[model samples]
Structure formats: structure tokens, C-alpha cells
Target chain A: MLRIEDLRVEIGGKAVLQNVNLHIPAGETHILFGPNGSGKTSLMLTIMGYSNYKVTRGRITFKGEDITYLPIHERARLGIGVSFQRPPTINGLSLRKMVEICSSDREANVDHLAEQVNLSSFLERDVNANLSGGEIKRSELLQLSAQQPDLVLLDEPESGVDLENIALLGESINALLNRGVKRSGSDVHKGMMQKRSKSALVITHTGHILDYITADRGQVLNNGVMQCSQNAREILKWIREYGYQECMTCTN
Target chain B: MYKLDSNGEVNPKDFSTEAESHDYIEDLAQIDGSDTAEFENVGVETDDSNRSATFILKDLSVVHCKSKQEGIEVLKITEAMDKYDWLKDYMWKDISPEKDIYTQQASESPGEGFFIRAEKGVVSKRPVQTCLHISKEGFAQNVHNIVIVEEGAELHVIAGCSTARHAERGLHIGVSEFYVKKGATLKYTMVHDWGEKIFVRPRTVTHVDEGGVYISNYISMKPVGSLQMNPITYLDGKDSIARFNSVLVAAGGTDMDTGSVVVLGAENARAEIISRAITTGGNIIARGSIIGNVPGVRGHLECKGLILNDGLLHAIPELEAHAPNVEMSHEAAVGKIDQREIEYLMARGLDEDEAISTIVRGFLNVDIEGLPPSLVRKLDRVIADTQDDMM
Candidate 1:
């Protein structure tokens, strides 16, 4: 449901992502694996239409619509949601209020959603105020769940979360992608073969999140270039065994 | 009788003109009562012909009327002294004895004020509303208000002060004293919406007895020429509590110097002072202080300021702990609204202006808990109105 054609992004007069091409068809989840400073987050932010990430060349199409020039809010309204690696703390804005703002219903059942992410007590607290890394991720996931976007972009879901909270984050991410039912072991093959409508583009450095959600495809990004696209598990295994430099040599 | 030196200290006056003072009172009386309807804009229920709460409306220096409410006795200062001998013992009992410039002016040019008392064991569900309104131009209105919540009683006082739109430059000096007796609770709320040429100086002090509670909520969301006040409170008895909360919005070149001081003097006494100031184009000096003097005392002060445009804000918070077992702390912050927060909200479906208004409203909301539901609703309405005005 997403396509990028020779996309180049520049931040603060420096090119961050160069001539990148990516495509995620409908009903599929793609994983983008890259090392540090490899333009993984820059790609996600540029696709999300952050104003600071100037698109110097090419275009991005989501569901056959040109969203490269769309504003952040417009993209959000068009069923695009993202969980940032580091979200800003909003003082005086309550977590529950933020969820309410994201929800289509003003009086949505926010308590239940927060409870799912083990954040019931934090509903009244200010958004991300004095929260730990895991807690911030949970809060972001809670908001994403409320939004129920068709295309979910997760930036480093497993980066700072503890082992104990990582399972919860995995379940929440799966639920957002409509893979929760399949993970529950009730006719998994049937659920996976039903032509899932939700799509996702998850960025990871360690590929730890692949343990929970089944990604349809994987692509390695190196030095602002997309090196290869292959089977998700095969690509992760190759990177783990041979490192990213070896992948660059193989792609060349 | 008092006189003012170049230093603005109170000095004894040898002689004064009675005719001049009488003429000031006469000018006050000349205010047509029909203008009272203008108060409706400031959240006063003017259409309520049966106005239940005790009201004190001062037009310049004249006492328009002092109405009494049930379960609470409201009397003019002179009438209170003449009616009850005990009233003499309570007047000026809690405030500072040494008169400052404002207190001296209040004494010298006396205006009609209220002596509101809630009887022992009585619970006044309806608030005692007082309005110190300035209707005339180039006049000084000096008022002295005394409030006493007797033992085991509860009272809520709502005071609204404002000036007429066309009113010229004026000065208002109010000296208020409050006494919360043993096991009593007093909730006081004051809303100020003054004209551009009005200057306000309010000197207030409160004393809380054993097991008593005192809560003061002050809101000034409209423009005023200048204001300076530092209200003080003493938690003198065991288990007594005092809380001071203020929300102010300064615009139109208004200069405000406001602060609160709370002293925790008895064991287990608790005190908190919270001030939130929002400056659009004016200047604000927000100050707060809390002192813990006895064992087991806990005190905290929080001061936050939000500057919108070319406005200036200065915050000064002080905390003192004299006893080893006492805990005192303070936090002060001044900043502009975060653009990221606005963008976050915008991405959540709100437009730019809507996002900004939401943040501003949340910043101004102090969320004083345990207030009466009706009063909370009224405060919310006033806050919403203020937000609309800001937009």
C-alpha cells in the first residue's frame, strides 16, 4: 500500500537519505534493518512528512495517492500513524486526554485501552512526564491503538524497552497490525491467509521485534542506500551472521 | 488619622477636611444603581432578583447595599461593631498591626465593607458573594472585609471585583482578614476583571486554627492597569492546612506583582502555594513562599509562568524549614508554550488554533480538588471565557 521512487531527503542542508526506493504491498508488514546513522529513522520521518526533513527528489505514494507533499496532520487523517523513537513530553496534557484526542469518539473507552498497555494509573498523569523508556513506548502504543491507523510506522519499538515490557509492546504492535488474532493461536494460518488489510513499516536496528510479529519482507538500508530486499527471516539471519558491511559487498 | 511622608509611611495627621471626605462619599452615592447590571458580564447572576448571597457593592466610596444570606451573618463594619460586642475582638485581629501605605489609605478613606461570619457548627452551602465595583472616575475606594468561620463550621465566599468600562483612573485598597476556627473549613474565591485605568492593592491575611482548613483561589484573567499584593496565612494549630492557588492573565500593559506566604507553625500542619501566570503583553512578577517551623510540618510552593508574546514574567519561590523533621520544597519555572506540543496535538486532529487553545486552557487550569461542583463549573466557565478572550 506504500511506494517510494528514488526518494532523497535532506535535513539541515545535509543529505540524509539518497535515492531510496521502497514498496510495501497491501496486507504485508515490512521490516527495515539498518545500522546506526544508516538513515532508517530519516526515511520514516521523511515518509511521515516532517517539515524539517526536506524531500529533495522523487515522490511517496500511499494507497495510490501522492502524499509526499501532504502535511503531518493531513497524513494522519489519511490513516497514517507513527510511534516515534523519542516523543516530546507535553506538560499539563493528560495521557487520557491525548488518547481522547486521537480517538474518533470523544468518550472512547480509554481506560480499557490504557489497561491493555498497563498504563491505567498513568491516565491522569501528564503525557510522558517523568516516564521511563518502557512507559513512554507504552504511552505511544496506547495512542496508536486509539488512532487505529491503516498504515502504522513504528520507529524502534524494542530499542529502550526492558525485557519484561517488551512482550507487552509486541502484543500491542501486533494488535495494531491486526496480527493479534493470528498470534493468539486460533487458526493462525487462516487469519494470515485472509488478506490482512492493515500494513506496517517497522524500523529496527537489532531485529528483536521480528520475534513477535511476522514481517512479510525485509530490506537492509546502508549509508542512505537500500542494499537488498529478501525474505524477512532470511535477511535477518544473513545480517546476524555476516554483518551489514558484508551485505553492502554482496549488493555491490 | 494618618499622614503620608515622602517615603509613603503612615504618619499622624493634625487636621483633615471632613467636607472633602463627605464629598467623596457623595460622589460615590451618585452612581446610578442601574449600572449594577453590567456585572453580569463577569459571571455575576444579576438576573437573580432574589440574590441569595451576601453582597457588598462599592461604587467609589459609597456602600450601595449589604445583603445577608441565610446561615451566614453579613454586616457592615460599623453595624457589626454596634450589634455584637464580640465583633470588636475579631476585627483587625489576624492582619498585620503596622499599617502600610494601602492599609493606611483604607483606614483614612474608609469605604463600606462586610463583616461576614458563619456561625458555629453551621454549614453554609450558598456562598457569600461580595462585589467591590468601581463605577466612577478618578476616585479611590478603600474597603475592609473581615470573615470568620466559627468552630466546626464551613463557609464558601465568592468575591468579584471589577470596574466600569468608561471609568477613568481609579485606586482600590482592600484590607481583608480571615479566621478559620477549630475544625472549620473556609473556601474563598476571588475573581478580578478590572478596567485599563484601575490600580488595585489588596492586603489579606488568614489564621487557621486546630484541624481547620483554608483554601484560597484567586483568578484575574482580564486586563488591569496595575496590581500588587502579597497575602499571608499562618497554620498555627495541629493538623491545620492552608492552600493558596492563583491563575492570572496579564495583557494590555498591565503590571502585576502578586505573591502568597504560608507559615506552618504547628506539628503536622500542611501548606501549599501554587501560582500560574500567563502574560500576553504585560509584565508579571510572581512570588511564593512557604515556611515550615514545627516538627512534622510539610510545605511546598509551585510557581509557573507562560509568556505568549513580548510579555515578561519573573518567578521567585522561597522555601524554609526550621525544624529538622519538617519538609519544605519549592519549584519555579518560566517558559513559552512548546511548539512541538502544538504540533503533536495538531497531528491528533486538532487545528493549529484549537491545539494552542487547548494547551493554554490546560496550563491555566490549576485543578483545585475538593471544590464544590457548582463552583467548579463556574470556574470552568470563567476559564473558558478567558480562553476565548485570549484567542
Candidate 2:
């Protein structure tokens, strides 16, 4: 559903991501494994068409349409949503109005989705103002749920979240991606996979999110370049044993 | 009207004697349709269902003034002064005529303003609507208003001051004094819309007794030539409270300097001042000050401004504590809209223009308590209608 080929990204005249090539087919969830400052979020922002993340070279295709130069709002209109790690606190813009903005025509989903994400009380609050770590995560999920996008980009979903909240967040993500209720499984049923084609690129540091949701593939990005891609669980086990430095030598 | 014992000859011409004066009208029904529309724009309507009392001042005359509610009293200040001998004590008692030239001019030749009072033990359900209107060119309209809320009473006053559309230039000087007795509550709101060449100066003072509450909200969004006002309040008795909220937007060629000061003189007294200003090629000076004179008092001052284009926006916030255990704090910011906030909204599916308008609207939407729904809706409409000018 989403493709980036030979992508070279720069920010403020300095190259941040070089020679990145990846693809997530329809109905698939890809796990992006990276250390700090490894340019994983840069790729996501580049695909989202942020003005500062200049894609100096390469093209991005979503749903077989070239969207390399779309504006942020246009990209959002074309069904791509992002959950920022540190969203800005917008004074006086309540979360309720934010949901209404995200859900253009389907405003009916605001209250129900807010209830599912456990942020109903927060709907009246100003956007992202003085929110705790877990509250920010749930607020983002609530907005994404209202958006109902075809593709989702989650940056470090479990970084600041506690253990129990991370599991609950994973369930929300799974429900968003159309994954089944069976947790700790890396396979989706054929009948279930054929029903929906919601794709996502989830970035994780510890792979603890693997316990609650299924990821079809995992790609290791080390220092501005892609290193390796393989079965999700096997790659996590290997990275846990050896470390990210070992993946720099893996050709597969 | 005051008779001059000095042969009716004035020297050192200020705004009062130098400017042209308009003829007085005996009845408001003789005015034209457009003049009535001008009155309605600033929250004065022909329909009295929404207001308990209505006072209309056209230039140097009180054309129409009456109170429909039995517990409330509304009349011209000059007539009310003669009706009740004690009313003279309330006028110019807290606000000195020697404070400024505007006060001097208003107190010396005081054209007719309103006198509104809430009787003791009465709770008014609807607000008293007052309109101060000038329909003649170069007219210097003087006004001195007195409002008294008796013990255990509640009152709300909504005053709209504006100039007639055809009247190009004018000057308005108003001196207002308010008294809130023990266990009383008063909510006063003023909305102003004027022509580009009008100069306005209003000096005001208020006093609150024990267990009393006072709230004042002022909104002026349209363009004016120049305006200056600084109203002060004194919380004298124990456990008294005061709050001031102002939303100001200055367009090109407009110069506005406005603020408020509150003094907490008794134990457990509290005060808060909040101001929001936006200038699009105009000059604005937003000021706030709080002084604590006793222990167990708290005060906060918030002044925030946004400069949309090439203009000036200055914020001055002052806090002083004279006793131990007095809590006072202030927060002030003056700059352009944060681009990060704009991008964050854009990421949520709003276009650039839409995102900017939303942020600007949010910035001006201060949480003011006790505003009637109609006035709230009118303020919302004004904010929305001026979106293009602010941009």
C-alpha cells in the first residue's frame, strides 16, 4: 500500500536519511527497529510531506499514486495519519474540535472512539496541554481512530508508556489495523486478512509491543540506511541476542 | 448640567470646549432608521424582552431611560442626583475629578449619563442594557455614570458605546463609579465599536465591601483613532473578590492603551486580571497591575498579545506584595502566532488558512464567567467577522 524507493532526505541542508527503500503491502504491518538518531522518524515525516523534511531525491507512492510533493493536509486528506511522539499543545483548541477536524464527514465516530480509547473526559480539554505520557498516547489513538485512514504511522508508540498501558495501546492499534483478538501471534487468518487492507508502519525500540499485536515483517535501520528485513519475531530475537551493530553486516 | 460661575467662558481649550457640540434630542423616536441600526450593532435592540432595563443616551440628552423590573432603578444621573440626596455622595467619591483631563472635562460639564441601582435583597435575572451614542460630528460627549448594588443584591449591566455611522469624528469621555455592598454581586460588561477618527477616554473606579463579588469584562474590536483608559478597583473588606477580562483588537490607524488595577486591602481578598490583545498594523498597549496590602491574599495577572503585521504590541504586568503570606503571580507574552502550532493543526487535516483562523479565534476566546448567551454569541460573531481584518 505504501512504497519508498531510493529515498534521500535532508533537513536544513544536512542529509538525515540516505538510500532508504521499503514497502508495506496491503493488510500488512511492518515493524521498524532503530536506535536513537537512526533516521526512522525522518522517513515517516518525509512520507507525510512535512515541509522541513525535504526529500532531495526519490519518490513516494501510496495506493499506486505518486504523492511525493503533497502538502501535509492534502496527504492527510488522502488517508495517511501520523501519531507524533511530542505533539504541540494548542491553546484553546479543544480535543473535541480536533476530532471534528480529523473526521471530516464521519463526525459520529468522535464520542464512540474517544470512549474506546479511554479519553472521553479529555475531549473538553485543550489539545495536548499538560497531558501525562499515557494520556498523550491515548489522545493520539483517539484522533487516529476518528480519522479512519488507510495508512498509519506510529513513532515509538511504547517509549514513554508503562507496561499495562502499552498492552492496552497495542489492542487499540490492533483493532485499528483489523488484526484479530488473538494476541502473541505473528500470523493473521486468511479470512480476516482478506476483509481489510489497512497498512501501518510502527516504530519500536524494545519490541515489547510484539506481545499484543502481530507484525508481518521487521526492518532494521542503522545510521541513515536500511540494514535488514526478515520475519518479525526472528529479527527481534536476533537483535536482542547480538545488538543493532551486528545487523550492519547482514546482507538479507 | 453644571452652570459655570466664571461667566461661561472656558480657557486652555481641551477636548471638551474645542470640539464641536451636537444638539440634544428630546425623544429617540424622532431619529432615523440607520441611527437605530447603529444602536443595535453594539447590543442595543428595540426588543426589551432580553433586557430588564434600557437606557439610551444620544449626545447630550437621555432620550429614553426606564426600568421594567420593579427591584431595579434606572434614570438619568442628573435627575437621579436630585431625586435622592444620598446619590450625590456616590458620584465622584471614589474617582477623583482631578485624576485626568478627561475626568475634569466630564465632571465639569457632565452631559447626561445613566444612574442604575439594584435595591437591597433583590436578585436581577436579566441585565440592564445601556447605550451611549453620538450622532453628530466633532461632538465631545461627557458622561459620568453611577451604579450601586445594595447589600445581598445581584445585578448585571451590559453597556454598548458607539458612534453613528454617518458621524465621522467625535470625542467620548466617561467617568464611572461602582459600589458593591456587603454580600452583593455585580457583573458589568461593555462593548465598543466606533469610527476610525473617534477618540475615547473613560476613567473608572470601583469599591467592593465584605463578601462581595465584582466582575468586569470589556471588548473593543473595531477601529478607532485613539483610546486611553485605566480603571482601578479596591477590595476593602474581608474575603472580597474582583476580576477583569478584556479582549482588544486594533486595526490600522488605531492606537489603544487600556488596562486595570486591583488592590487587595483586606485579609483573604483575591483578584485576577486577564487581557488578550491582537494588533494588525495598529498600536496596542495592554497593562495590568495588582497590589496586596494584607496577608492571605492572592492575585494573578495574565497579559498575552499577538502582532499579526507591522504594528506595536506591548504588555506590562506588575505585582506588589506589602504583607507576608500574600501570593501574587503574573504571566505575559507578546509575539506572533507560533508556526509550530499552525503546522500541528495542519497535520490534523486543516488547511493553512483554516488552521490560522482557528488558532486566532482560540486566542481571543477568554473564559469569561456570567456572560449572557446572546452577548456571548455576539462576541463570537464579532470575532468571526473580523477574522479577515486580523489576518
DockQ of each: 0.48, 0.71
Q: List candidate 2 segments past 4 Å from native.
A: A180-195, A248-252, B1-32, B370-374, B377-381, B384-386
A-chain TM-score of every model = 0.92, 0.92
Cα lDDT tens digits, model 2, B48-155, are 777888898888867778788998999899999899998888888978888766677877777888999999988887888899988877778888899999999999
lDDT of 1 by residue, A1-252 (tens): 889999989999999998999998877899999989999988988887877799999999998999999887778888788888878777677998889989956456899899889999999998888988889888988998898878888899998899888887898888778777535446666766574658999999899999888899999899898967888899889889988878778556
Q: Give the per-residue lDDT digits (tens) of candidate 2, residues A1-252.
A: 899999899999999998899999988899999878888888888888888898889989999989999888888888899988888888878999988988878755678888888898999999899998888988988888888888999988887898878888988998788775643346557766665858999988788888888899999888889867888899899889987777767633
Provide the lDDT at B198 for model 1. 69
Q: Summarize candidate 1's per-residue lDDT along B360-381 as a digit string, tens digits.
A: 7788778655444544565566
